[model samples]
Target chain A: MATLGNSTNIFWHECPVGKLERQRLLKQKGCVVWITGLSGSGKSTLACSLNRELYTRGKLSYVLDGDNLRHGLNKDLGFKAEDRTENIRRVGEVAKLFADAGLICIASLISPYRKDRDACRAMLADENFIEVFMNMPLELCEARDSKGLYKLARAGKIKGFTGIDDPYEPPLNCEIEIQQKDGVCPTPGDMAGEVVSYLEGKGYLHYQ
Target chain B: MATLGNSTNIFWHECPVGKLERQRLLKQKGCVVWITGLSGSGKSTLACSLNRELYTRGKLSYVLDGDNLRHGLNKDLGFKAEDRTENIRRVGEVAKLFADAGLICIASLISPYRKDRDACRAMLADENFIEVFMNMPLELCEARDSKGLYKLARAGKIKGFTGIDDPYEPPLNCEIEIQQKDGVCPTPGDMAGEVVSYLEGKGYLHYQ
Candidate 1:
């Protein structure tokens, strides 16, 4: 039989020591930097660039891009709309954990819906979340055709592909939108510097 | 009717650019360091200590400790065995994503069951996974009673308390074991050195 109205003391719970201390030691605050865009619009390129830049400066960071994530964590999850929601939901939860522990988390996904993106925003406080839009025209991404995904989608071969059979709601307001339609990307060095500068502006960097 | 088949060109789905090259430029090798122990066995202590050491050395690394994870990613998950299995499974999936993108993933959890630990081990290739055991005696852990969980278990206040009412299967094989029965722990500097040396021995740090 289960006991009713039983009370347990919270004091008995073992507390984890040194997490906040480690954050303080890092001197810069940790948060999630989510980069959203259409495929081949340069999300991964920007994310990798940013990760390398942070690495060079001795900042603890990791990038969770869409292709890599789908191949692994969300592999069992399918391309259905519900699955997409679940996919982003899982990533949001994981990113919150990463941010809490004071690591710079950069996740790049083709998360097309504003609601999904906003849900992620609600997971963390305003100061801890950064969203970057890699905005490039559909034609341009198709031209690059990095994975030939656009071609497949056009042939009705790949259903629910964003920017073709699917929809991508561009962010109305983003902290930064790097448009590659002009065919210019801030080098990984520049992009990293830009992100760090933002963190600096937010007073996240105290160690340096 | 659903037309589901193997991805026509699954191999071509690989990320166009290599992750290793990015890791090299970042000056770090991606790997997952999974630490398992009983509650109050200094898992978080050692995890943070290791993170601090890596940060100071300018290595890209992140720590996913047990409590913080529960606070976010696994917030809804309970302590039941099935829930625990799902919890570690999710962590393993996420850790695999981080490792694939070329970051050092350090996770410390009680992870009591050998089957659960083995599940995590199987998720990664042999070279990318390293398991460390924190072998502090149950009596010592209860004496410390860091979480007061031990006391609760003794008083019949808490059901299924690991190492007390619940069972904890020891690791059959581990990469390193911290024999802390005498209350001595390696300096963070030493542990960090060991990780770096292991990476070097595995030829993961050759970039200038």
Candidate 2:
């Protein structure tokens, strides 16, 4: 039952209130909108915009950004390689829970490793895991430098920082991609709309 | 900023759609119903029963028992002392996230340490963390031994088993307590009714 390192003899308990029933109540399919990109690529902005869009449409959605989680769930984890892997793993599991509760879970993270992201994708049904890659150029994100993180990384103050010292493995076959057109990046609303339309076309907008 | 041990320089991302809006959409206040008791104290039984009861009332509630989480979110953790503490902490954080998503989260765990349980309580507001103590006597729980855990513990096969080898510090001031009436253990429905009534009286069943 434990299925891993140490726990043993534990049994799985099934509840009567299952995912299908929750979906019926919410009137929308539950899924994870996983946004992956480099730092300063407006992942949080797109997440917030998508959340607002869903709310206005009478749909339930939640954003699992690092701000709320780092201070709480993943606070004990650091920026080490293993810590980052564990960090993404925990966030994936939490997102899965939010999805199971019949809400669209928007997870925005600068997850650099492809293996880690793939591992998270394996936790859910293939269709339920909607990966959205923010394919913005490093030059643009570094120029934005919204939080001065890029500067720190360039100055060698922050080692292994994503997009500077560490590599960001873009999603090979993401469900949606938010990229620039004619050298101009789209606004947060447009970016969110791109993902929303994908969700709609995929029949995630309604349960029935 | 990271509040605790390792994470640093992370900023809090505030979404436009918040708890109040989500509560309004769900028509119910979000909170955690934590059921704590001995192994055979019927915590999961009461949890599932209460979940069904809430669903019948058109309320959205999800149960986070070991059956669902230990194999996913907390699979990395074991039954070691420190691992147990981390286990409770992660559950508490996930419950907080569920509450923020505006769903009644039912968490069933045999968290014996008062301090660990209190730490979870401290994560949320004073009124939101409703601790339901299944105050069945140890002898009664041992006699039932639904999972044969007590028999194993008695045979010295399991060390540090709560209520057998480990100490189980009861809650000093819990929100609700379900106990035997006239030497007869209450049915799962009856125990769930006690909590449902409490939720009704406390105005958790509705939102303005």
RMSD (Å) per prediction? 5.9, 1.1
lDDT of every model, 2 decimals: 0.73, 0.90
Q: Lowest summed lDDT over 10 consecutive residues: which window, candidate 1 chain B?
A: B1-10
Candidate 1 docking class:
incorrect
lDDT of 1 by residue, A1-98 (tens): 11212223222122333346546655557789999998878777777777766666666666766555565566656778987887788888878766
What tens digits encode model 2's per-residue C-alpha lDDT throughout A5-67?
467767888899999999999999999999999998889999999999999989999999965
Off by over 4 Å in 1: A1-31, A48-61, A96-104, A139-145, A151-157, A180-208, B1-30, B52-61, B96-104, B125-128, B151-159, B180-208
Q: How many backbone clashes are present in model 1?
A: 3
Please give the C-alpha DockQ score of model 1: 0.18
Poorest 10 consecutive residues by lDDT, candidate 2 chain B: B1-10
What is the lDDT for A38 in model 1? 89
